[model samples]
Target: MRFLPRIVTFFLLLPSYAWTQTMHNKRYNVLLICVDDLMPELGCYGNSIVKSPYIDSLAARSAVFTKHYVTVPTCGASRYSLLRSTLPRTKAALGNEAAKILSDPETAIGNEPETFIEQYRRNGYHTVGIGKISHSPDGYRYPYAGPKSDQRELPRSWDEVSFNPGKWGHGWNAFFAYADGESRITMQGEVPPYEAADVPDEGYPDGLTAALAVDKLKMLARQEKPFFMGVGFFKPHLPFNAPQQYWDLYDAGHLPLTAVPNIPANINLASLHNSAEFNQYRLGEESAALDQPLSDGYARKLIHGYYACISYVDAQVGKVLQALEETGLADRTVVVLWSDHGWHLGDYRVWGKHTLFDRALRSVLMIKTPAMSRCKVVNRITSTIDIGPTLLELCDLPPLSQADGRSLIPLLNDVQDKAWADVAYSYYNHGISMVTPQFRLTRYFRKEQPVIELYDHATDPLETRNIAERSPDIIRQLTPLWERGNTGVYAK
Candidate 1:
């Protein structure tokens, strides 16, 4: 009788043991690097002025997404969408949604409410979030009552670092401090001295976050556990503060200027939300010289500053990558570097990203996988939503019901049997922009009125000429496509 029981137990345990072994072999690690307020202006993206060697190198090793667009333009809204893999209706709605989730967890939005980090945790992968992974820190806290509403309700997935406390706009060499309620004049290109204990760009919140990530990589290597690490960098967004060396690299005399003409008189200012606020900041620049023709020289200087911040962020990325390589995690790790949304350096007569312009909506996305060859650039149109499903596929995890993204695995594997097209959508305030491989169509909606703008991206990459009136049929063809909601895998 004892021998019979042992035989039965051995037979039963075989399947479970085989399953465990399969799961272990299929597990893959993920490293998600997110930058704040960055646009697709890196050297890999063909910008000559910005010096982002780390990102450039990463680009060489990954699939460079040339037409990746975010669902929103602002930081909080855009990051929320990327985290959730869903687009917000408008800027105000997005902000309010974030506020509600942070204020009262029970009332958070989204029907399918699970974060990718949580999913990775469910699959036995260790997860860590550093820096600005969540829109605001408070969002991570519980609701004081029942089950928490935010996707982070799954607590086991993340381990966050302490918030680095510091002055808001200290690092950048900009002339004005948007810090206080009232703007004040500050010296431009002035690099303040710092103590050895003082934080460097990498040592600050972003740098500390990256350092913690590197440590986690090391720990994971020892344990042989697959990890999903999210390292968020907060720079090049506002204050534009970088080390003195970075600021010195850009000569204001040769900076490139913005080239947006005056807003047409026929357009209503009310159509664009928060136009007055944008103009207020521009007027505050106190540059009598900018009143004349916009010059690329001045624009190049701002570009240089933006690039310095990017390079600063890139160095942190290199740290994480180095740790991955040293830990022998590089071969199995799937690295994805992305920005929340594009930044506007005086494009469309706007200094920031609150509008539905390409400069404001586009982002840089690079993905490196063990399955793909190096230096491959995919010029297809994709969205932030695709990130969720793609990571899930990479980890061999089952797709979540709430995820509205599609897996880019087929695209990554270079499977010619599959056919894909470039199609991305972006929204800000009340405006929505649909980007095809060759065309960008924007529809600005109001309470009772709507305006449409179309640009042939192949010819008018800058979006200077609006051909909406000239191409009515094309507008008609694309409007219906925009109307279809949740067209991704989750919808099916």
Candidate 2:
């Protein structure tokens, strides 16, 4: 047998995905920042243009997962899989309403504490969730344009779950709110796709969420219990709106456009869309379609709005990080910054996240622990489901049985870990896509011409073409590994 050299590792490994290392006797707290519809477009992710200074600074000291993929691409389903430490098994589980099951009367019975937050809360951690941590902006069950309900999205997860709707009157309204407190849901096709308001950061709901997070940190800092805090910021999602100052940070005329703005080769149109979600903004400059690309001017303008939203949210994150330092809780807390999923800035002529392509499935993830070695990029593939277990291990809490997620604590010890299984799974558009370091194989459960699509990342990093038709041997070898991800949840 081949031999390898001895190596050092974290001393507190125990059980499956459990770690007990600690900083003195103090309990470790967590501050989770959930950013909506964000890709790895930050400065640290090698996007030379998108202004994400705060997140970049955090990435400088954190274990950044460059290949982190979401179980689902949409905001709600992705977050549902994230909080539950599971993958999508049902069609509903792949939708925005997936979190409502946590409070379901009949089905939620016999659950293992509903969500990871509930797991923490049950174990004496003071769990606080604000903004859109689990689907709903305010953690409540309500229609997009209906009256607010007392029902909680994850009924037993957090000790306190909340969000301020500001002038929007309700959480759903705030989610789609404009600068004038009107939402696209209520106004119905009247709003544009983007906005740049000449107002302060507080003019946006995300700004208010940040201020609330800062306040909560200040309050939680004075407490004695170990805390689990989720701070969600809604920006760079839709109807991209931010303060004028953040908007001024970019020049639309000089913004970069998607290199491959047209559709990919040989994939079915069923795998793509006519940008129906982006079309909801009826007053936008131009509509995005699979046939042709958006005008260069309009595309640049949309990119400008997205970049501004990112910078605006980045400022809010900076505020919360500063609050942690000011409250003297920075040394005892683990900060995990993640985006629910990625977005298409006209990538492959798509403007949304409902597809199962790499552009939609891959997102940004960074975990910053007090004892972690200075900023390192873990090139290993990781899944969103792994986050919950990683948080448990990082905070020295007991491990829970997850659907497929494993502990990432070991990766912190060695970024180039050969023992790591470099594969991540995602489900959406009635399909399952698996991403490895060298390949991406997608199997769609539909009657499309090309049910199997494969992209070799080693040579085609841009995923320009599908080579599955020609690479029979590679596909045959990879199929069994990809099949492991099905797990009966995506069964018909």
Separate clash counts for every candidate: 17, 1
Q: Report model 2's TM-score to 2 decimal places.
A: 0.95
Q: Pick the candidate with the highest lDDT.
A: 2
lDDT, residue 406, candidate 1: 73
Over the stretch 442-469, how does candidate 2's per-residue lDDT look in tens digits? 9988887799899998887767788999
TM-score of each: 0.77, 0.95
Lowest summed lDDT window (length 10), candidate 1: 1-10
Candidate 2 ranges with C-alpha deviation above 4 Å:
1-21
